[model samples]
Target: MSVGDETLRNVNLVTMTDPLLGQVVEQYRVESLIGSGAMGMVYRGVHQVIGKAVAIKVLKLDYADDPEMVQRLVREARTVNAIRHPAIVDIFGFGTLPRSEQPYIVMDLLEGDPLDSYLKDHAPMKPRDVIPMLDELLSALSAAHAVGVIHRDLKPGNVFVESKPDGQKGIKVIDFGLAKQADRAGGSVKPTNPGTLLGTPAFMAPEQVLGTKVTPSTDLYAVGGIAYQMLTNHLPHEAPSAIEVLSQKMQHDPIRPRQWQPSLDEDLDGWVMNLLSREPEKRMKDADEARRALRRIGDGKTTGAQPVSGARPAVRTATGVVPRRDWGEARTLITEESSGVHDKPADVSTDRHVSPWAATNTEHPAQVEVEEATMPPQPAPRQKFQSARIEAPTVAANPDEVLAEVKKKESQRSLAPVALPVDAPGEVPVTVPPSRAGLYLALGAAVLALLAGLAWLLSQK
Candidate 1:
């Protein structure tokens, strides 16, 4: 029989007789089909020796000839096993079913709902409720990152939440199937071919959409996207198709979470923004930094302060100065700057680090408004100084003409009664330019008159 026919035959046999139902692989006895996907079938099973329930995920016979797919299944099991975190799902065993020659992996049978399902059934979760999950998520990611494993696929569907035997909630991050080692790129077995796009579009970082190398920060970008959904009942970027979603993210930033849901408050909004930074380096340098920022929110230390529009919260130093943390790993000091949600700059300060996606497009209209809104008002004295500087060259060309211009300006300024000093009721207050050539000219005339009077008095003597 052809490979296609053989695969169909196995599917029919498994469905009809449930042949694996009483069969044993290692110590686990397959009971029933739990689920099936393009790559594999999952079964609910019981460990014969321990009598504990475990999930069996079996690679389909249809793809037996596809070595890369087989390797990816094995890699998923091995990669997840390497990172030991409670928030991550556990792998119990791995083997092949003798009857069909299908490979299988045993994992913790998650009894709880996927976060995606839970959110659909329940009301939108409060930020407070989401914070703990994010904390655990970060912990899982932190462990994974420390060992150089980047969870390329992180979405609500991949996260499972269950109530433990102790009645407390527990989290399990599942499916490291798309995960790639930090050091290697463009060579791993991919759902699409190597270097092809991966990850759900709504949660994808700009780099992922652009098919660039992903790092630990790439995973956190998805965390931010998930947090946005948890808090707002929506994805940060959403469209009917993946291509449209990618186009939108490339065109505009996701609307600020606070703007979508006003209750997120200032600090929490800023914290999420930090995670969603388009530039990887601009994001929290590592998972640990992200955790501490969240901890600050939980502890209520970062209250009342909104981060500056499109800027990360300034890190307060020992001297109480809040230095800008946007430049990534390098500290630039901006003191006493006010914090408020503002439109992100089309190009953040220097051109060297501007997002490539943004470089091609004109600045968004909203960002223009932000640039205008955040612009500092020029001080009056500074304005006057600038005026004088502009006219300085003209003054240098003709001293008398420049002096006359200065006198005229002073005269115009003095005409405003409010600017004149109060004098005796009947007397008009004369305004003179301080250190003006006109004042010196009047003083010289007075001195000449006095000298003429002195000479006349001496002649009479």
Candidate 2:
């Protein structure tokens, strides 16, 4: 259809059935609301067909009315369905209601508070405490990267810690809402305005902040930010504005992780710095290797954690305004206090432990909570670092520029249709059953090769 005709059809679209309720697509009952975003609301739903619980994300009417948004949502659903892994969010299927232009994704529902709220409530977690979390995050990233899905945005808010039936910990990384297919040269997301950021600024990698083309390594940079914050309750740094934070991420060197939490090990400090490297090429290229590093730490296999045979545990910071190493220790100790009401825990004590990666001070790590009553009415302004020069737009990003143009036209309330594939039209469905199709295919191919070889040998004889 012509762009003008498509625009008229969408402009006069009649509102249809509300999908947040029980829109029985493929036998799933869309029940209660779980969450909502700029795009649409997510519902806690159950599949009557399979008797399984799922989270259904329906595209918003405002966006669904636009052809570009409809295509974007469909692309996301297709990309997500293509990848299958336990660590990544599992997508069951996609469905479009009778009259809706866009589709919704059915996914596994995960339980947990956002990693940010969880951290703010429990900061200054021991270095050992953070290893397992990092291990899970890295494992998820590795699996996603293997399947050619780059989670452009990785932040504390996106990681969900789920409770396992057996009491062992499990994690699920969500919001592949922004994930891009690896082979695609351009982004599926576009900003209607130029120079406006498209990702979470605080956790976005330097390359992502610059709006430049990105690779798997870019996600690792954000992973580095999570590790850095975990090591110290405080961020390596913060800013009053998103653009300013992006500037620092793209240019300034972050203070070493151990500098904020002196108890952190030197090797860990180095690892965090390396992951947070401004240049993507310099960072850990593969998340699996980083996950292996996390495994060593969490499993008590890192050489630094070996117990000393003769040396006694040292005591640092016996009396002082808490050392830089113990910066957020006070805030994490108040277990019983409500979000806004509480004093620092006075019963706190440090392990006085030191390791190869551990930081050392002349005195023991401090154990004092700067009380809630003592805080100032307003927080102080964050120090800003000088931003670097913007590089020339690379040829690699020309397609992204086109996407941006499309997004600009999206805001006008007109839904223009782009050219569609004419020959093989509509969606082709593919599903993998629980049975091992790969194994069976391999066995069948092996039998065919063996028979063909025997036939050739017998004829020659």
Candidate 3:
């Protein structure tokens, strides 16, 4: 189909079923429509060569005629491929349909619901319960930031909490369709109109809504928004319309997570609010530091006690604020009050601690913890350093020096008479004459005879 025809067809595609379902696109056989949105429709597909399940996302026909839209579609795959993190969805291939103008991308077939859906059943998760998810989310953003890709849209719907074939749950950040190039300058493609909203308004940062240059911190802001949702069971900001939401995001301060979940730690709420800062400069420097902060909060030992009826933890003036590198300094103030709400048992007991790598391999978790939290947080264990071997360069020496060195060795060997060298393997042993065992015995007999004669002489006297 021509670009105009494709665009016309997709203009009315919002309520219609995808036409490509049950058809083969490249190596994938589309089975069913997994979901649909303004961008495109995702279908569960089967790869013919590998016989593995995959998720096929086809670009909307309305965007087929737009050059910037096409580039952004391809850029999403390229950005995801560049990030190359386990927490991000794995892209298999990118292509356009054989005869249709619709472009498509193939990625890992996730086997569970998006985090938003997961939250419908398990909202307001305990800090420890959601720490792994937060770790994975921040890790994905960190990897994207390292490669200069910022995920402009980071709501819970884009994050998949999948249940693997094994009985383990994994976190996968999907849909980089709204991702922006962090360092793109003249070579970048502007996919949307100026002052136009690009991401989900609820999770967008103020700079994003105001059409400013986005950095890694923009993604960090989204992470904070999602963290707020995960902890409080609601978005940091919500409204009936996109304009209102955007306006509030730009104008208003976010409600503290503790406002909804008073049992939460103040340090945790401060960190979340720091991420939701109206100014980009006020947020964490990058996702890596944000991940570290969340890990610190997660690593805190808690009593896992649910709040008693009508009881609330004492709230104090939040001090030391965010942007401080030392999480401990910011956290020390709330240590006593927040101790009871931790998701772990109050007594020393074994707790399931899954490592970052456990998502890929469910059979073997990287770590499990069995310790008491009676004391303050201890310093992280020191890492052992491995020494590397260094060899000096070899150089040729003069023949005279070699001869003198050999002679010195020979003189030293001659001076030490009893220093016999062991023979090399397969070499004949050096023969020596008799040891002086017989001579020593004869001398001893002569000494005894002389002693006997002396004794007789003494008796005669």
In candidate 3, list every pair of residues with a backbone clash.
none
Instruction: Please give the CA lDDT of all the candidate structures.
Output: 0.60, 0.56, 0.60
lDDT measured at residue 142 in model 2 versus the true structure, 0 to 100 = 75
- Who wins the TM-score comparison? 1
In model 2, what are the clashing residue pairs, if there are any?
262-325, 264-358, 265-357, 265-358, 266-357, 315-364, 316-363, 316-364, 317-363, 317-364
Off by over 4 Å in 1: 1-16, 183-195, 303-366, 370-461
Candidate 1 on 1-461: residue-level lDDT in tens? Answer: 00100111124334556667778777878887766655677777788877998788888789755787678778778888888888888886777777777777788887666677577665357867788888999999889887788877787767777777987766788888777765442122222343456566667777775555678888888898888778766566544444544555654556556444645555666667667767777778777888888888877766343223453322321112122334342122212121112211111232222222122121233232223223322211100011111211101022233234445544554443232456679877665444457788999999999999999999999
Candidate 3 on 296-373: residue-level lDDT in tens?
A: 767764334333343222211111112122334324534532344222111111122222211111111211122222
Please state every model's RMSD to the true fold in angstroms: 20.4, 27.3, 27.2
- Give the better candidate number (1 or 2) by TM-score: 1
Window of ten residues with lowest summed lDDT in model 2: 1-10
lDDT of 3 at 255: 46
Q: Give all TM-scores, in the order shown.
A: 0.63, 0.59, 0.59
> What is the lDDT, from 0 to 100, of the residue 413 in candidate 3?
36
- lDDT (10s digit) by residue, model 2, range 1-461: 00000101113322345544766766888776656555666666788877787777777777877775666566556655666657656776777766765577777776555566567666767877678778878877776777777877677666765666787655667666566766543222333234544556666776665566777787888888888877666554455544445544543455555545655665576567668767676676688877776666666566655323432222211111233344354334222221332212222234434443223211222223355344222222234321111211111233344344434533321332222324565765443233466789999999999999999999999
- What is the descending TM-score order? 1, 2, 3
